[model samples]
Target: MSVNVIILNGVSSSGKTTLAKAIQKYSHEIWLHVAMDSFIAMLPDGREFDREWFPMVEVSREGEVLPQMTNGPSGEALLLEMRRLVRGLSETGFNVIVDEVAEADTIADYRGRLGNGCLVVKVDAPLSELERRERERGDRLIGLAREQSERVHNGISYDLEVDTHAQTPDALARLILERIAA
Candidate 1:
């Protein structure tokens, strides 16, 4: 038997994870939250100190704060595995929800990897709201969301787009479910 897959792409603290959880809770079928954060957490101990993906921040000419992401061999390999995991799980009839912080190039890669069967949702919040959530969460880089906001959704054709600040996660999940049904 086949199952559904949902890829929720968004910046940090934009509520992708929250929405993913809500989707899982409301869905009749069991869903695995296979997220980028889970892959990131698998990196070796020193990675967070010296080998982190976004090691630092840079300010753009327009003064937008941005996180600089660098992927060495290890990071790249983990990402490859993450994509494979998503494909493998869904193919084996497990419903999956993936939350990611993906840019245009990354989204393109996913488009090819996930094929037409996956529902790609663009999750976002206002910059102010994103920053607020980031601060409240207290785990992410201070300006990562602001920097990611500049280009995260650029040039991708999404199946659905939801604003976390505009509605509760349950409402957004229902909207996403509706979109999937359509």
Candidate 2:
């Protein structure tokens, strides 16, 4: 059987990783959870925080602080390499679940590469709830959810939409499995 890839796109603390893990745990199919965060975490020391390499800025609006990442050439190259890695895994018949916060251009880039067997899912949560989750997680950079709230889903539609605030991760994973089976 040909492998299927489910791409979960959302902002920080939107539960994409949680849902991806839930899907892998509960689903009968052996699914590889491939997260862009993992690829980003693999970046050489200091590269992720270096402005010359990654080019991030902090902006404050209405007392809310947020970070803006401008992925310069180096960052873009890494993203492309990560996308290709996901593609290669799927092409080799590994069912993959990708967790990413992708804007329109990045989504388009993946669409062109992954082609027919890929399903794009929009993982959503309200900004308020996302902010709360980010705070609770403690590991995420503060304001990341707010920074991405408006841009992550811009100009994109999905094969499935799941709101983390509305359902449990297992419930959402089950729903995705049903959709895939259909």
Give the candidate number with the greatest TM-score: 2
lDDT of 1 by residue, 58-165 (tens): 667375546655565667777878888888887788888989987777777777876776888999889999999889988878888877777778988888889999
Q: Using Cα atoms with residue i matched to residue i, what is each candidate's TM-score against the true structure?
A: 0.90, 0.92
- Candidate 1 worst ten-residue window by lDDT: 48-57
lDDT of all the models against the reference? Answer: 0.81, 0.86
- In model 1, which regions exceed 4 Å deviation? 1-3, 49-54
Query: Which stretches of model 2 miss by more than 4 angstroms?
Result: 1-3, 60-65
The alpha-carbon deviation from the true structure for residue 168 of candidate 1, after best TM-score superposition, in angstroms, is 0.5
Q: What is the lDDT of candidate 1?
A: 0.81
Lowest-scoring 10 consecutive residues by lDDT in candidate 2? 45-54
Q: Can you list the residue pairs that collide in candidate 2? A: none
Give candidate 2's error at residue 30 in angstroms. 0.8
Question: What is candidate 1's CA lDDT for residue 68?
Answer: 57
